[model samples]
Target: MDFLSWYDWITPTNPFASLFFGVIFTVIIGITVWIDTKKLKTTTLAMIVGVFVTIFGVTILNFIGFYN
Candidate 1:
């Protein structure tokens, strides 16, 4: 199944959905960054920034009536 359908069991309003996906995304990004650079600091920073930006950006989009 596709990624969208993978999360179908999780209702969008559930806070855990966001937390779970955020951690999952962060871990994925961390692995990719580590494989590419082999640096723990860089990987950590990239994962944190990526997760923050993604969540913040989505929140802003929803605020501006983009998601709904």
Candidate 2:
């Protein structure tokens, strides 16, 4: 019950791990943005959103002591 909720709400420990893992995600987003740019598509906004969201989430999770 509570354990499950806690697990769901809490984040993993190790901010460095989060950032390191997040780099992969960020790169993927960058690549997507690049493709979109090549196509002259409107995905740059989405990529930026993703980048910010990922960074915010990771930072909160790692820095808020929720990961512990």
Candidate 3:
């Protein structure tokens, strides 16, 4: 009946772990970008680069059977 108990279910062995972290990171980045009005362009460009890097990194990891 508590949040920690529910969070305990999302372990490294769980299939949703990667997805959960990915969503969490995306949300964090979104919030940072939303709050910084002065450097929005630079921040967004950096986020785009980060996204591409993550995509390629995950694809490479999966291709090499890192998950298995």
Candidate 4:
């Protein structure tokens, strides 16, 4: 199975679990931003990465038919 299928393991949404993962994801990206001294370059790259990640999340949610 490919990676998108992994969310199937979620089975159901648990508010606390989702919150925990959100914090973890935020922390990781925060650290990456923190370490980069080149403000312009890093900020641009970070924005690109953020947009793509958001699109990817939508794809995953669509694939899983989360709204249905």
TM-scores for all predictions? 0.58, 0.49, 0.54, 0.44
lDDT of each: 0.68, 0.61, 0.58, 0.54
Q: Which residue pairs in model 2 clash with each other?
A: none
Instruction: Give a tens-digit lDDT track for model 2, residues 1-68.
Output: 13233233244345555655565666677687777576435456656676677789877876667657
Model 4 misplaced regions, further than 4 Å: 1-38
State the lDDT of candidate 4 residue by residue for 1-68, as single tens digits. 23223363364243333434544565567567857764767755665676566556655765777644
For 26-68, candidate 3 gives per-residue lDDT tens digits of: 6578668768754877677756766666566666766777656
Query: Model 2 Cα displacement at 60 (Å)?
Result: 1.7
Q: Whose lDDT is greatest here?
A: 1
lDDT of residue 38 for candidate 1? 100
Q: Between prediction 3 and prediction 4, which has the larger TM-score?
A: 3
Ranked candidates (lDDT, high to low): 1, 2, 3, 4
Whole-structure CA lDDT of model 3 = 0.58
Best by TM-score: 1
